[model samples]
Target: MRKTALFAALSVTGALLSGCGTAERLSRIGRAPDMAPIADPTRDPNYRPVSMPMPAPQDARNLSANSLWRPGSRTFLRDQRASAVGDIITILVSIRDQAELQNTSERSRENSESMGIPRILGLDSSYARFFPQGFDPSRMIEANSNNGSQGTGRIRRNEAVTMRVAGTVTQVLPNGNLVVTGRQQVRVNHEMRDMQLTGIIRPQDIASDNTVQHDRLAEARISYGGRGTVSDVQQPRYGQQILDAILPF
Candidate 1:
């Protein structure tokens, strides 16, 4: 009976060892029932780089349209509405009176004469000549008379001319000409000036402020404004002649 019991114990121990070896082999082969699959992150097409785009900065002062024109504003002429080119505008400047002119003339004459310049006391006056686009003196003389005569030239009113004031009228000459007593002179030309007119469209003037939002996610609670300008240059009928008078002879 003792020999039979020993053989039976050995058989039971062998069976237990065999069962543990089978479990080890199954784990090595990845055939174990509870084994998890390996994760491959690179296999995902949705994977992206670590870097991302940041949100843009907000400008607080830029909120209002008038803010653009305020001193120290970020938006300059280039950014303003009136900043655009091709804008046309006009401006007018009136001449001052005779007493004021006399005072100015006296000061200038004193200054020039004191500086070792010639002191001439008289108004400078001259008749300005006006002709068509193409003027021929020979043709003009021939038109006056068949025989060339000094005082027989025909002056046509087709050319428009205007009297320009020059220097200070020191004295009235016997003939109605002004004795201009200075070096300065007046010029005749197309009067042109640039003027800027800015137009602003406030948020309230447009649709409701609530309709527009700051950020895509947030509601717009701030007021907004837009601005623009109109510009033009205006000239008189005889602008070209005016330019010529202003130029130094």
Candidate 2:
């Protein structure tokens, strides 16, 4: 019995040692993997991060229209007189006859009456002094002289009266001389003349919406030429009579 008990104890100890050796070998294998060096993320030149660009603010200097109208520049008025004359002629020639004039005159009178003003008020003609066309108020920068790169300049609107006389033509003579003598009631039309506003924009204040205002003029005129004869003497008087009949002022 003592021998059998001693043999069982030895057998149990050998089994435990064998199990421990297997477990240690597995642990050694796992530890071997940990001994390798970790990879450096920065060392990879090809692993570039995706990048995005930021949005830029709108630049006014890039607008071509805004750059044309510089403030306080008189270059815009170079041909203004000729333009105004052309516009007046166009309006006059378009009248066609006394019938159209009567219609236009009646309309003007009605408009004036509706506004609660005198019916026979003088029809005054004037030009835009410094009309700002396509002018964006938000883009208007105050004038500055110090900054060369800054768009700091003055912009002006200008207007003038080409002609201002009371009356309408009773007849456009066959010889191209208008007869103004008749006192018969007549009419006139208010029309828009083609006028251009020219200017420039400074470099810094370029984002302005610079545009011209159209059809702002309310009055126009007609001209006639005559040699030193009875026609010349009677021409102005006839014109005055026609104006009185139509305008009644």
Candidate 3:
């Protein structure tokens, strides 16, 4: 009875501690757990390791164990499907995009004023002795101004890419989606082409011939391009780029 009571009290304490240290626990999300010679939290005061959720490997089951390959069996005519890591799947890349924009602005403003003295008041003649020979009271009260501005801009862009690359499944998710990654590099004379891709795909999306379109992949990232001596020559110098960013004139 005493041991049972002690166990219940320890369980309650553990629940309370975990509930209060939620954020503290998340701080070690990316850290590796303690390896060999696993230390007890109470026995090794200096040893500390973190625990976090991690993706588990897919369960591999052997279907051949129960299925037989008879001369006229349906299994004999089944198509090969990519459902595991290391399986290769062809990806068809197709992309086309275009954009165009134009902007224009214009502004104009003008102002003018004038004042004249009445001859009956004689106020203009009262200050005649202190005024310059060519000075006029009416002209001193007049002002005129004019301002105008015009701006225009235009931009156009077009991009088209089409190619094919084979990708290998690097991981299989619990839901049966495959995480794929692929890279291709080709060299021709003085030029080189580099291509890379990564994404997730469902087995059902794969064609009977073991091929999948790039647009069918989820979270897909595909990049294709080339670089060589000719490319370097076409690029602007670093100094020029910095000047473009900093100079207004």
Candidate 4:
């Protein structure tokens, strides 16, 4: 009885919490989603400095007399690409993937056994008194077993995405690699689409147009999702989701 009461209380609490969120969304039923204010990314509590392994420092090579170019410089003229912290650059995101898999297996087993006391001292004659009529001591015990199992699995997936967003260089690692982060939000009617990207990039990978491809990024993280009336309707109810999680088959 106590366990039942505790479970009921927890369910009530979860429903109340879910209701609060629904009420907030309901208040904006007819209005468009509000845009977030622009702020400093470095000021966010979750933001941290990036660290990476660095190669041993090398001495700068002396340039030839009267030479216009400097050692370790990509261009003779001033480079316009993003190389310092806080610089902005464009990111080209393109992805296309597909996968298919199938597997099958079958197993079977069978066993049989027989045991008997054909002769035990001179007491074999007494079996007729305690055993069934016409008892056969040669086959007193017998057992047979058979088991079989079969399984099959299959999976198929396909995905594609393309977008362009500007990212800010958040940190310059000791090895000269830059850490970049960006976010984009678009609101149409009552629905809002959101995209976030973060990764480490090399300065040399940036093209002459100040843009870098997604493939050039290392340790990349990309997210694309949306929230609105249609999205909420498509999701299962809080109570149903909770039951699906806790109920045992």
Residue range 1-249, candidate 2, lDDT tens digits: 999999998667556645674454456442321222333322345433222233454544443565665543345633221121111111112222322111111111111111222222342111123433433333334442322232334444443323222222222323222222111111122211222111111122211222111122122223333222232344454335546767945
lDDT of 2 at 170: 29
Stretches > 4 Å off in candidate 3: 1-79, 113-126, 129-140, 235-249
Runs of candidate 4 exceeding 4 Å displacement: 1-15, 60-65, 71-75
**Any runs in candidate 1 off by more than 4 Å, and if so which?**
23-36, 39-249
Better of 1 and 4 by TM-score: 4
Model 2 CA deviation exceeding 4 Å by range: 1-92, 100-217, 230-249
Q: Can you write out model 3's per-residue Cα lDDT over 130-235, one digit (the tens) per residue?
A: 7756566555667789999999999999999888887777777766678877767776655557887878887888887788999998888898877554554576
TM-score of each: 0.12, 0.14, 0.54, 0.86
Instruction: List RMSD in Å for every model shown.
Output: 44.7, 48.5, 19.6, 3.2
TM-score of decoy 4: 0.86
In candidate 4, what are the lDDT values of residues 31-102, reduced to their tens digit?
877777777778888887777778987776677898887655666766778999889999999988889999
lDDT of 4: 0.88
Candidate 1 structure quality by residue, lDDT tens digits, 83-180: 11222111111223232111111111111111221222531111114443544432332222122223223332332222221212223223222221
Candidate that would win on TM-score: 4
Q: What is the lDDT of residue 43 in candidate 2?
A: 38
lDDT of each: 0.28, 0.30, 0.69, 0.88
